[model samples]
Target: FPRRRRRQAQAPLSPAMATPRRVPTILFASSVAAEQDETFVHSLGLNGLLELIAADASFAPYEQTLFAESALQYSRRMQTAEQNGKLDRRVEGFLNLLSAHFLSQAAQKALEYLLRHFRVHRHNSASLLRCILPYHGTRAFVRVAQLLRGSEQRGAWLRDGAGRLTAPPPRELVVGRAAKDTELLGQLTYLGAAHRVAASFSAVALLEIASRMRFTDAEAPLLRSLLEHAREGIASETAPDRRLVGMMLIT
Candidate 1:
């Protein structure tokens, strides 16, 4: 007699897994979705993503905001579904688990790796720098300084008297290192989060980095403001341990 085939049971999908997979990675000034779709980024969850971006230091503010909004909306939708009984009770558990997994040290390492290898178009770098400045202020400051320095080394200098001595060029020049320096200086001056992150620096580090950069006379005020803000920040925060570290850095 032939034995009857054994029946197999399929594992059920968690409710979170049933949510929409596609999410816009970046939100622009026009509220348009970026061409790049981060379909799998949602698996990281909201707080998990916040941790990742905080550590990664590459996602601009708009992108970070977009990720945050998208994650929040998705989570809300899931909560609603659970309330409505459209999804299994396991969805909440899955979300909690996802957050746990992404917050692990291993997940942080993966994010760092992605940051190091990720490349954006040259034209986009300035905008990216602008976005990251508020979230990772001191690091972004150093980065912009480095860009200015590199541009200076590449001969992007404007003759101090040339513009004052004669009429300005017909159009904004975008030809050489001077143009690059000008653009970078403008970016550095306008960075939104500079004051917030200024205090993280030891006074010495701030001075040293500032002196090393080729900021023009016109940019002095911005540099001075950042330095002053940083000093004030260091003074107001009373972390004795870090204060000791700052002294060590100073020495």
Candidate 2:
């Protein structure tokens, strides 16, 4: 009867005091666990942000090195599978995008370099001169025309204090319209024949050099004959039979 009474008394204490203690301890442990989880998630997000910054061009090499070191240090402390997976995906995507951007810039630079070489140095010629002539204004064209005319009359001039002075005399300076046309035709014929020869030689030279340079077919055609008379003048330089042979071979 005494043991039963003591057991009943202890049972009342257990229900009241022990239950409250267990409840508070469980709640405190849960609150601590939740705070730790929040901290871990926050740290993972911060690491991802840092990785994005490192992948950008604005970061210097030294700064990137420091960021990498810090990231490695922080990553070692990460314990959750979910946090690690999220971080890996974010880092991989950022790196892939960054690599593509750099590759695009490199490709653009290479293309520009090739174009500049082809335009400026490789294709410099009188045809290039003529193509650009229209852009130089009407006054520039007129000036060039006057210079060419003066060059034609150069034999009729004498060296004077003011350079060449007309020696044909004022009376002999007949402004014959027909004479002007004849002189212009002659000059044009000469210029055309000379340009034709030059162009043919240049084309043959280009083909030979291009072959040696291992240039693609796309590049060879860009070196087209811009002058019309170049081929005719080249043909006239050789004997008729030899010229025919060369022509057949070229075709």
* Candidate 1 lDDT: 0.35
Per-residue lDDT of candidate 1, residues 79-100 (tens digit): 5644434222222222222222
RMSD of 1: 19.2
lDDT of 2 by residue, 177-241 (tens): 11233332223223232333323333343234323333356433322321222345447664343
Give the Cα error of residue 206 in candidate 1, in Å: 1.3
Error of 2 at 78 (Å): 4.7
* Regions more than 4 Å wrong, model 2: 1-69, 75-78, 101-251
Compared to the true structure, candidate 1 yields what TM-score?
Answer: 0.27
Best by lDDT: 1
Q: Superposing all C-alpha atoms, what RMSD in Å does each candidate have to the true structure?
A: 19.2, 35.5
Q: Estimate TM-scores for all models.
A: 0.27, 0.16
